[model samples]
Target: MDVSLKNRFLKSYFSFSVGIWFSAIISFLSVPITSWLIEPAEYGKATMFSTIYSMILLIVLIGTPNGFMRLYHSVEEKRKLLWSSLVVPVFLSVIFFGFVLLFKDTVNIFLAGQKNSKAHLILVFAVFFGVLQTFSQTVLRMQEKGFSYSALQIVSAASNVLFVILYALLISRNFYAVLYAQLFSNILALSLGIYLHRESWFPIKIDKSLVKEILAYSYPFLLSGVVWWLFGWTDRIVLRMYSTFEEIGLYSAAFKLVSVMSLFTSGFSTFWYPFAYEQYEKNPNNKELFSKTFDYISFLILILALLIMSAKNVIFLLFAKSYRSSAYIAPFLLLQPVAITMAIVVARGIDFAKKTYWYIISDGVAAAFNIIGNLLLIPLLGAKGAAVTTGLSSIIVFAIEKAASEKLYPVKYNSKRAYVSMLILIIIASINTFFERFYVGILSSLTGIVVVTLLYNDVFRKLMKSFFEFLNRLKSMNK
Candidate 1:
């Protein structure tokens, strides 16, 4: 095994983490601004509309962007594949968006408590920008443009925070802040994506063969992404029907807050793809890379959830008490990051195995299970039920993916390391959350963070060394 490759992966991991850290920091800091100026009801509308828009995003984008990653320059017969990837989704989005617009009023009932008329208008731009952001980021990653991806995401996040601060704190009093911020962020990200496309120097030709492979790969992704959106975002819609708009607002706040943990996986996942592909291409049997990544990610996500959950009281004290009671949902929500990372691993493995359809099948089964679980659980359990349903489906889907992938690419996780660390962090969260004793919870959480740190310590040191060397090389090039 090449030590340098290991170091490179670690360095890449840190860079990815730093991006998420910045994004999360800005998000945490934005709370005070949001809570002070935007009323919970208004923010709730923002959340609801956004959630509806999220569902639309999956339908509009149609998963071609993700499929492009696997079918990029590496595949022979690239042109047809590229066209297949791009043309079909572009046409589908037009039809999808048209359907949305035609039934705007009925959809508005599902999407918003009060129709702004303008809200529907905003959705157009939001979905348009979202496709740009998604496609641009995908293209960047396929070319192994990690730094470009990171930079664009950072820029988008920063711009979003700035515009949101401007609107929420300075100018507007309503959900326009969300809309405006989203618009600006998407435009900025799309621009960066365009810039990186030029910089990456990849061929842009699209053709039939490329499209065939892309479609073949992306059909599973398209279905999976749509199902995931439904599974993930359905709570707000469900709550909207059964509960008050304000309740939906509270739930949205809680939901978005919990989603913060996803920064761990999202920030690194795109970047990890090329690294993993390179590793597999070079040394298919190097179990250490996958094992280490899993353990480190497991440790990383647990620590993230612990830190967020540990500081829940303080956060609630500052934001809204309505959300305080909802903190109980934190435990189930923490499972999401693990589930997402695991899902990514499993999905990738399945694709590697050439059983892409099995992925679609697995997710379809899981999605059905999730919807059924939600229908049964949500009326009684509320948002908590939705969280549990989402998580259970994720585990089920991941298990199926893992099993199916074994035939094509046999891989094993660091089971002992993952299990032990996972248990430790879960215990830590239980102590911190269940006990009323703040000092004990606080101390135990800190200790737990340290323990999690220890799990990734070797990787962390190697990362630091690699980073400094990377920086040094950059400095030399500049000179």
Candidate 2:
């Protein structure tokens, strides 16, 4: 890459990454505060509500955002393209809402109490705004306006936090309040997003050919999303079914803590498709580039896992004493993102080859494993069982996806180094889980850190060298 292009990528990466990092911090802060304010059972119920909402949102979206991003750069009538993307999701969402109405009693069973009718209605709005926010943010990204995209993201996150705090203070801190906060925050963000991109909403003509193309690209994501959602949330749903809400609450809290890993993964996710597609378009022969990129990203995520796992105790201290037991699963849960990152990096192979059916198959198998694993384990072991099984399922999915992707579109990834790092992580995590001694956990963490550093010394040096070189340039410019 040329210096200018490399610098632009780095700048855009950090610009957007800082927004995700800030959002993660805000989200992390909300958990302990919300947990403290609400009853454990209520917190669990609210979390259950959010989980269901996420699943529905995924279904309603039908992976259109990914389709939109993929097609955005190529299409001439971006406005029509954007509006066309919205039509199917909006139509599907309405149909889903109708079904929710038809099955009012069934939906309320999960929600239980506190204005059940109102909560369901607000949930529909949340899903609507959620889809809108996703498209608007993606549009900004498609335009390469990283700073604006980051601004809106930070605003949405900040507004959510602020709303939660206000709701807890002004109203009740129960599930109702949580739902109300979510509804208002989504509305606020969506309104701002629409205002920012109001011009694009015009000339709303449906291009049949473009719509077909987007659907062709998005269909696999639609299928894979459903399977992926099941894989991600079956543990919680099963816990709700077989176990108690309190256990669910504890598990949910651990998930919130582990979500900090998204601060890193989220940034990469935003950059990856656009970056990957751009690189492939420029040079399809850049196999080594993709492979090295995967190794480097996997290692970075491992570093994040190491940092979070090592500080698991300190991090959990922010939770209520009743909720602190949630910390035990943090080590396992922290690795979830690592597994996800590996799959995402390697999946580039399948994406370039346009064989998204592999994703559907991979995720379907993994979701089944997760469901079966949760069933067998939750009854026997509780939250810890859920954690162990979930981690194992994630790794299974990654392995399957990587194997399939490599076979289809070979990328000469540094498999040995990557596998070694993963092995070390698994061992150290197991040690920490079993021993629970402060020194043992710390020692295991140090060992993992050492292994990662040894494997990634070159990447580390290059990063540091870039930092110093940038600083030197800044100094010269100021002088």
Best by TM-score: 2
Candidate 2, residues 1-479: lDDT per residue as tens digits? 45786677777778778778877777767767877777878776777789888988888888888778776766788898998888889888888889878877677776755434566777777887788877888877766667777777778778877777787778877677777777777777678877877887776778888888888888899899888876777898889888998998888888877788877788877877777777777688877767767866887899989978888878888777998777776677777889888888888777777677888988888888889989998998788778888877788878888998899888887778877888888888777666767777887888799889889898778768888998999999999
Candidate 2 C-alpha error for residue 237, in Å: 4.5
Query: What lDDT would each prediction earn against the true structure?
Result: 0.68, 0.80
Error of 2 at 475 (Å): 4.6
User: Per-residue error at 139 for model 1, in Å?
Assistant: 2.1
Q: What is the C-alpha RMSD of each candidate to the true structure, in Å?
A: 5.0, 2.9
Score every model by TM-score.
Answer: 0.78, 0.89
Q: Please provide, for model 1 over 311-377, each residue's C-alpha lDDT reduced to its tens digit, 9 standing for 90 to 100.
A: 7666656555666755654555565577667656645676555466776677788878877887776
